[model samples]
Target: MIQVHAWADLDYDVLVRDMRAVAFDLDNTLASSKQPMSAAMTDRFAELTHRTTVAVITGGRYELVVSQVLDAIGGRADRSRMHLMPTGGSRYYRWHVDDDGCGRWKCVYAHDLSETDRRAAAASVETRARELGLWETRVWGERIEDRGSQLTFSALGQQAPETAKRSWDPDDKKKRMLVAAVSRDLPHLKVRSGGYTSIDISLPGMDKSFAVHELARVLGVEVGGIVFVGDRMNPGGNDYPAAEAGAYAVRVGSPDDTLRFLERLLVRL
Candidate 1:
């Protein structure tokens, strides 16, 4: 079983010495949800990449990662060491050097939903939302988004301001209820709570654990050799599967806490 530890409880030196790769949850862990990466974080991440492998797995779409994450890092880090698994690990993008020697991200693999499954899942979410009185709630932007491999329902809308999203479901009561309803209505699809305002529905077995195994294969490391850092590693959170898959898990509270953990990890690495 994977153990969850606070950043303070970890022996920084021993932890870094044993790890082969470090994986992170992008949204609230690497950067605030829907926001650009901070300068300090970008620099620290670049430095971290120099020492070992780094990967980011998120429930957001790949386009969102390019705009909010990669663009902010500005290409100084080694792309060979970076792995991007978007759509809650249902899709993976890897850096590739073309024949012309230019580097770019290529889709290594994607567990895309069939049209039939997508339609049914979408309909189920809508029907359940209406049943739960969520359909009448005011939203800030697109509430339902199709991320190829995952269908997302953002209660406050995907583009809602961070403050609004946070205020909408600080305790996750609304989202937990919605998750339960959606799971019951769409038993075939995997439904899990993401960030503060979103629920991710993907094909069965396509959660972060899938991404963890894929990363282990790519990096040539055992599952136990990897470390995962995220804001939501508790039961029912999206990051929980990585822990279930046997990766050493560090559960932080926010982006600032993530940064602090990274800072300490870098010192040891």
Candidate 2:
């Protein structure tokens, strides 16, 4: 018999009564950059949803983010209670499409920085950077992800190699260094690291944390009614949004760790 960790065998009557919903940050929370959640996680999530709503919020693009849902939670009927908020809290969609195939989808804020501006900004930033010799551009498909906002710098014109782009700073440490360096140069913009390899800049107050708060209004639950789990909870990271919303923040170890975390949460609730 598989020896389930003590985490798998917990009592949940305490921490759950007030929890109207449970939100998770994708990537490291639900699935690691390398693997998806194990069966243990999906089953645990299924178990948890029997008591409270579950939502997933991530900085990953929408198309890619939903696939994670399909993987860990394919056919659970309570899926209607599951929510998927993607793009750094820039988008929201509830689980379960209605008869016509639509439940709830909201795109709060987005921007398109095309190649001209990308070139202009990159030229400005890179040229100044050259003068300072502080930074270099890792061109990815004419799309200058000035952080993660997806600037159409090259009009999505010529593409850059995904392998090369991802390798630019796989751990995101280099990207963090780049954010600090560029923000020092462009102080007016809010520059921060997101996902695994991207740096994003936005106007102040343009972030997912606030987005979660905004999205909470739709759930009709106080921000405090939600418990958010995520791996990245640093000051300017993507997961910071959920942590900031007055929600209970549960930090876990890996992509699959969330499953066990949920199981513990369910039993303890």
Candidate 3:
């Protein structure tokens, strides 16, 4: 079993103060899966940007992050200090403020797959899931989304309710099976389980590990100088890559835990 630690288990003051950046996994870490971030969480996140550089790295698309996170925090944050790494870090966006102080997001880099690759990936995921008897007849929204830098396969559909998604595959068995099959078919691509009942396929080097290292390079901090917080940090979980890349890892069970973590971090920062 993965060892679990409480907030008090670490020397949080020293850890928080020494860190140059704090990176987070969005879905379950910041909000309920595919749900909007709560007002309380938004306030704490906005407050965090002022004290330290913040990076949101997730398997979600940029637009999803915008609606669920950025828009919710709207105008209350130091956008310049915030970095958005989405599509499992295959793409990156940073804030740009215009003369009138109207801030907008600007893409820094995107490792989008070619049209041919995208088609192949989508085909492989669908074919394998069906072969494995994992495809759902009823879904909430688009099951396959062509995110620029990655392709996501939401088993229950993108708009599935949180309760249903949570109950679908609590231990990630189904997703892991799907990931393994898709990975074999698309050997050159990176395939991993994402969110509650989803799979993410991207370029080999594009993942949360890439996000961590890239952020460290851009922010001029050593790998150890960044901390990564997430809900899923187990071996094959999407958030595992950040921990593998050497970011100090903090795990939270829900957004409430994330809020409490932010509260403690703000006190130290």
Candidate 4:
């Protein structure tokens, strides 16, 4: 088993120098929950891409990645050096740079769930959450979403503010109950905790583990040469799968911590 290291404890110079790629979790790692990258983060991330291959693997859809990350960095960054694996690596997008310097994203692969699987996951998620009294009475936006390759259940609704999301189930108790119940009903599907208060349902083996290998394969690097950084590396956290996949995983406290690490890595690279 791989040991998760605290951001402060890592040898940034050695790690950054040897790593072929750096992958990040979107929410709480690269940006605030459901929010765009901050100005500092955008600049640093754009710069980092120019130095080494980068990727953002999230439970969010392609649209969210574009809105929350790519849009913020714009053409300033080297998109060709980056990969976007949305929906927990169920879908992968690569960038194609044009002769005029404009870049376009291409969907190289997608593992979208079938309609039957989507229906089953959505039903199981809602039914189990309600049965366990974990479903909220009121929500900010959507409680359940069909994200093409994944079905997500957000406890406090998809549009819940960052503050509310942070406070909803800090202990992960509520999400644990919901995830367990849903998983039992959908034995063939993969269900894991996502973002701040969301549960992601995807095809079996289609988690961050899949993302790690996919990134390495696409980048033509060994799995050990990739460094995945995220806020969640605990057993049930979505980021755990990356560690399980044999990548050097470092756990950070928040996006600020992630930014600081990126700065150190940039200096080393």
For 1-269, candidate 2 gives per-residue lDDT tens digits of: 11112223333554477667878777667765524555766677666667777777766656556556555666653776767666565555665455897654444445434445444556544444345433445443434434334321221122334345445555656655666776676565556676554555555554567656865787887887777777766555567766666766666655556666665566566
lDDT of 4 by residue, 1-269 (tens): 58887888899878977799999999889998778999999999999989989999998888989999999999899888899999999999998877997768999899989999999998998899889887888789989999989999998898899889888888899888888888899999998888778899999999999999988987788988989999989888889999999999999989999989988788887
The model with the greatest lDDT is 4
lDDT head-to-head 1 vs 3, winner:
3
Model 1 lDDT at residue 22: 95
* Lowest lDDT 10-residue stretch of candidate 1: 131-140
| Model 1 per-residue lDDT at 146 | 89
Write the candidate numbers in order of decreasing lDDT.
4, 3, 1, 2
Question: Residue 4, candidate 4: how far off, in angstroms?
Answer: 1.2
The Cα error of candidate 1 at residue 201, in Å, is 1.1
Stretches of candidate 2 off by over 4 Å are 1-13, 96-173, 184-189, 202-204
Off by over 4 Å in 1: none
TM-score of each: 0.95, 0.68, 0.95, 0.96
- What TM-score, to 2 decimals, does candidate 2 have? 0.68
Tell me model 1's lDDT, rounded to 2 decimals: 0.87
Best by TM-score: 4
- RMSD each, Å: 1.5, 7.0, 1.9, 1.4
Note the Cα lDDT for every prediction shown.
0.87, 0.58, 0.88, 0.90
